[model samples]
Target: MIPDLSHDRIDRLRDAFRAAGYDADGVVELLGPEAHVALGRGEPVPALRATTDAGPLGTLVRLFLLGQAEPQAAVEAALAPLPLTDAQAAGIVVADGDRLRAGLDVRPHGVGDDSWWVVSDLDSDLRGGRPVEPDHVLGVGHASLSLVRATSRRPVGSVLDLGTGCGVQALHASTHAQRITATDVSKRALALAEATFRLNEIDVELTEGEWFDPVRGRRFDMVVCNPPFVVGPPRTDFTYRDSGLAGDDASALVVRQLPAFLNEGGTGQLLASWVHREGEDWEDRVSRWLPPGAGVDAWFVQRDVADPALYVGTWLRDAGYDLRSPQGVQKAGEWLDWFEDNGVVGIGFGFVTLRRTDAARGEVVCEDLRHAFDDPLGPESDQWLRRVDWLRANASAEGLLAARLVTADSTVLEQVSEPGDEGWSPLVHRLHRTDGPGWQHEVDELGVRLLAGCRGALPLGELLELLAMGFGEDAEELTRAAVPVVRELVRHGMLVPAEWAGGAQ
Candidate 1:
């Protein structure tokens, strides 16, 4: 179903939603916390029971959010300002006997007064456990939310949101970007995205084509994509998840091609998945997809990895297939067979952040950071690029030795103790960063003393000299040994340049 993008009709619909308080917080308030959380989990019985005899807000929730048919009079009263006849003509609703049923899903996203409505085809639950359509335009899902949370919000001249399903990323980008251009290969998705933008009163250039084809020869200051990156066999079933490219090629293609679309100093962020083959490093496979030479600096953080069986099962279930069913089991076996034939061992999922650089050689970091992080990753992403730039600028021994450095304020030294002949002898010492990604490093006595002396008062060269003299080691050798260690400390944000010290800097 396509949404009506007429400005007047959308405006009236927005007004009706506002009047009924059918927003994120309002819905949660009307249905208690338990019911709201249950609704989110796709168990609509609690919500249906709670909103059965409620008010206009409840009626709207039943019709639009829960996908339940309501009495025509109740739906009309719920959408007061927007006439029911107008809504029917707009294809937002259809008559089901004496009741009114929603043609599509319109759900609220964001917090407080900052919320906006997203329009898309009904999901499996709303569609009564039916399989999703081939060209189903997905609404706000975990993948989209993850990209939004990880993207840096710093203001930029222009932004491009590639494969913008329902235009979720574009909507958020509008807050910081001077202009936004969103593209999708599916015309139905573009239509729904248009309704999403129009309903929110946001102006964004909408285009249709596969991947970067829509914006050829044009560059943006920032680009964000949550592409159809599901790693699978070369088959096209769903437009939102299946790229129709064999195995991880779709992900590799996007990563390899994004550099050409970014302006100088511009940054790009994307979510991707890659095949982890036996006897091959996942890092090598992903990093090889990055642009060559000094064109872009890249960071690949693998958040999770799933073995082939689990991976196949997860995506099969996601496509609304019951694993116990014969069709599901047969399909799973075929998928596993394909994986076996192709040497696929596991699948790694994560975020990829890139920046255009002019250095002779760009820094590329690939790490398995699977730990839970409390804060949003946006600040860390920005800080990582800055730190890499700083490291590149101070790469030479002479350059690094001339600058004074201070340990991060969030850095905490912990001593692990074990009972011995003497009372509580120290077994080990570790340095931990309390904020950001919560990186931890094991330290020795020398490392402890080295960090203790980093108070921003002395140049690194002088500090190394003093330490070597005290330890009766060669000064030159100590400098050579400590340089790489210092670089690592700075890279993980355990230390910062004193002149430009900030938590994220």
Candidate 2:
């Protein structure tokens, strides 16, 4: 636990920031990523490597990212363009000490709805989890967001959050559900979650249990379980990392039994793991878990595929132990042996979402796509709001794509091509076309050209025509190409409908 924040100190820090020529917002961004560096390393992080424009403040920001403690000497050496006041420096020093000791980084921005995060033993090493030390920023990897949204598909009468480490999903679900029953096995984890709710004054039913045992038969309208999905053999110290289950199959088992614990018409939102074996399809492995005739929209996205050695070695290091340790080496070999015995070629990680449609019917849809971590889906708890709205309004993919997308500030267009392809493959811009939908876009060269011009009101057809002239492609052909691209963007939230206030799925 960390010390309580003193308003006087915060005020002092605020004044210091102002004195150093930073407005409230600027200081927040400066502090967000740098704070992590400040904790991770003892020295101040340096400024931008490729650019010279960041100035002294930027240098200080880098110093902070390196986990530097009061780079006072570095500051003096660099002779910052805008110097910091002593009070500002002192307050930062105090704050830095507080954060470093706790192994936490409180981002200065976007902290709504269970925003506080501790770099997990797994996250710090594996390079996963919340981005920018805050809540889920909107329009991150939308597939994971899709998995997250699927959890909210239920009526949300009452929700249960299992393994609520930082309480990210729990806090978001709180607004939709009448009440939340959150459970975790770790006392440290529970306490951290308790502190978060207490600070925010959000109420949730808290309990200490190994999986469902604590809340057994205590049914909920929706059950959200983001368990330790890393598939490995048990460790001596049970943590947020290892579930102590035997293999990847454990997560599937949790999904299998989860329905029994949910209210009729309730949905079970599961971020799960399964074995990608030699003779078995990973999707088939999950299908065996769904109850007969259960209405399940199972989207199992194998975002990553790792073999036995790579898979076991990755997790073995997560427990603060390395394969170099003789015992560690032996334990790692056990995991390797287990995968080999099962004829598993690789492991699959993704979601198993089940919605109870009707007592007599069940369905499962397994989708495999490559996606990344969502670093910015914050405060948008009701994703279905825009999704359902777009569905109602557009009525078709073509219509949806025809809708205009408004990209926001600090957004970028990320183009990923299929491996071994010659053609300039489809490009998806990671832009905030609108709230509720912030994924990727079908950006033909013209769309990119149009995107460069999409700062204001411009007809989609006209944009395509402009691109057609530039690329020497037929304007109608370009428009046709962009239509499907636009629809896909809208469907995947790369281009959200206008007026979407951005809710979680």
Give the top-scoring candidate (TM-score).
1
List TM-score per model, in order.
0.96, 0.55
Q: Tell me the TM-score of model 2.
A: 0.55
N/CA/C clash count, model 1: 0
For model 1, how does the per-residue alpha-carbon lDDT over 312-407 read when each residue is reduced to its tens digit? 898887778889999889989988998999999999999999898777777899988899987667789998898998899898999999889999
Worst 10 residues of 2 by lDDT: 131-140
Deviation in Å, model 1, residue 329 alpha carbon: 2.4
Runs in model 1 deviating more than 4 A are 1-4, 43-46, 111-113, 502-504
Model 2 lDDT tens row, 1-505:
3333334433443343344433324534555566534533533223233112344454334433333343454444333322334324322323344221112332222223323222121133222222122221111122334455545433467888877775666766766788888887776567556644553457888898788888886787788887777776554334655666767656867777787777765666767778786778777877787755555434344556777788777665544455787877887778787777767788877655555544243435465645554433222323433343455466564564455555444346666655445756554534434332234444445666766765435555666677788778897777767676665444455444445424222
lDDT of 1 at 121: 82
The regions of model 2 sitting more than 4 angstroms off are: 1-27, 32-44, 47-100, 103-155, 234-237, 293-297, 371-505
Q: RMSD to native for every prediction?
A: 1.8, 12.2
